[model samples]
Target chain A: DVKVTQSSRYLVKRTGEKVFLECVQDMDHENMFWYRQDPGLGLRLIYFSYDVKMKEKGDIPEGYSVSREKKERFSLILESASTNQTSMYLCASSLTGEGHNEQFFGPGTRLTVL
Target chain B: LAKTTQPISMDSYEGQEVNITCSHNNIATNDYITWYQQFPSQGPRFIIQGYKTKVTNEVASLFIPADRKSSTLSLPRVSLSDTAVYYCLVGAWEDTPLVFGKGTRLSVIA
Candidate 1:
C-alpha cells in the first residue's frame, strides 16, 4: 500500500504568520502535487513538482509556494497566512508515466488562519 | 486536459447499483477517464480508469463509449460505507495535472 503522511492534521495560525505544511510519500513516486479544496470551488491545484528541486505553479499559485528538495518530501509554504487562506490542503503523488496512472493522496491538513 | 461535468448530488439505497456519468465533450484522444472516491476529512482515492470500452476492478467498473466523449462509473451493490464524493477527472497520465471539478456527492441510505 502507498502511504502519504502529512505533518499536521489541523493547524491554526495567526494572520501574517508563516505556515509550512509538510508531506512525505513512501511510494517513491516522481510527481508530487499540492491542492486546496474549498466548498463549491472543488479542488484547485496550488503547485506541483515532477522531480526533486523542480516546481511548477498551478491554477491558484498566488500566496503559496512549494519546496521539493528531496524525492520523498514536499512542503507547501504560506509566506504570510491570512484569514482567507484557511482551507483543506491535500498532497498527492503519482508515477511518471504516459498511461493512466493513479495518484495516491495523504490525509489532508486543515489549516485555519485566524 | 479535458473538463468534466457531473451531477451535483445523488442518493441511493444499500444493495443498489449506483451509476454516475461524467460528460467531457472536448476530450482528447490521449486523455483517459478516471474516477476517485473521497470521504470526509480524507483525501480522494483512485477507483477506476479507462480509455474506451469497459474496465472492471474489484471495487468499480468504468464504461466508455466509442466517441469517448462521456463515461460512466458503476458501483455494484453499494453500501452505506460507499457513501462519499466521487470525482471524475480527464487527463493524460504523464504531463497533465489531475484537475477536479465540483464532484458528485453520493449519499447512501440504509
Candidate 2:
C-alpha cells in the first residue's frame, strides 16, 4: 500500500510567524500537491511540484510557497503566517500524468493561526 | 480542470443503496472521472475512477455514460459508517489539479 506521511498532524502559530509543513511519500511518486480545505469553500490548491526543483502555482497560491528538493519530500512554507491562513492542509502524491490515476493523500495537518 | 456539479446533501437509511450523480459537461478527451470520500478532519480517500462505462471495486462502483459528460457513484447497501462527504473530480493529468465541487454530504440513519 502507498503511504504518505506528514511531519506534523496539528500545528498552531502566531500571526506573522513562519510556518513549515513537511510531507514525505514512500512510493516515490513524481507528482506532489498541497491544498487547503475550508468549510463551504471546498479544497483549494496552493502549490504543486512535478519534479525536483520544478513547481507550479495552483488556483490559490497567495502567501504560500512549496519546496521539492527531493523526490520523497515536499514542504509547504508560509513565509509570514496570518490568521486568515489557518486551514486544514492536505498533501497528496501520484504517478506521472496518464489516464486516471487516483491521488494518494496523507492524513492531513490542521493549522491554527492566532 | 473540468467543471463538476453535484447535490449539496443527501439522507439515506442503513442498508439502502446510495447513488450520487456528478455532472461534468465539458469533460475532455483524456479526462477521467474519479470519486473521493472525506470524513471530518481527515483527508479525502480515493473511492473509484473510470474513463467510461462502468468500474467497480470493493467499496463503490462508478458508472459513466458514452458521452462522458457525467458520472454516478453507487454505494451498495451502505452502512452507518459510510456517512461522509463525497467529492467528484474530472482530471487525468496528474500534475494538473482536480477541481472539487461542493460535494454531497451523505448522512446515514439507522
Best by lDDT: 1
lDDT of each: 0.93, 0.90
Candidate 1 C-alpha lDDT tens digits along A7-93: 999999999999999999998899999999998888899999999999999999999999999999999999999999999999999
Q: Write the per-residue lDDT of candidate 2 for residues A11-81, one digit (tens) a residue.
A: 99999999999999999788899999988988888998989999999988999999999999999999999
Q: Positional deviation of B17 in candidate 2, in angstroms?
A: 0.5
Q: Could you list the chain B TM-scores for each candidate? A: 0.97, 0.96
All models, RMSD in angstroms? 1.1, 1.4
Candidate 1, position A21, lDDT:
98
Docking class of 2: medium
lDDT of 1 by residue, B1-110 (tens): 78799999999999999999999999987888899999989999998888899999999999999999999999999999999999999988774577888899999999
Alpha carbon lDDT at B55, candidate 2: 100
Per-model DockQ against the true two-chain complex: 0.77, 0.64
- Cα lDDT of model 2 by residue, B1-110, tens digit: 78899999999999999999999999989788889999887889888888899999999999999999999999999999999999999876652667776789999999
Clashes of 2: 0
Candidate 1: which docking quality band? medium
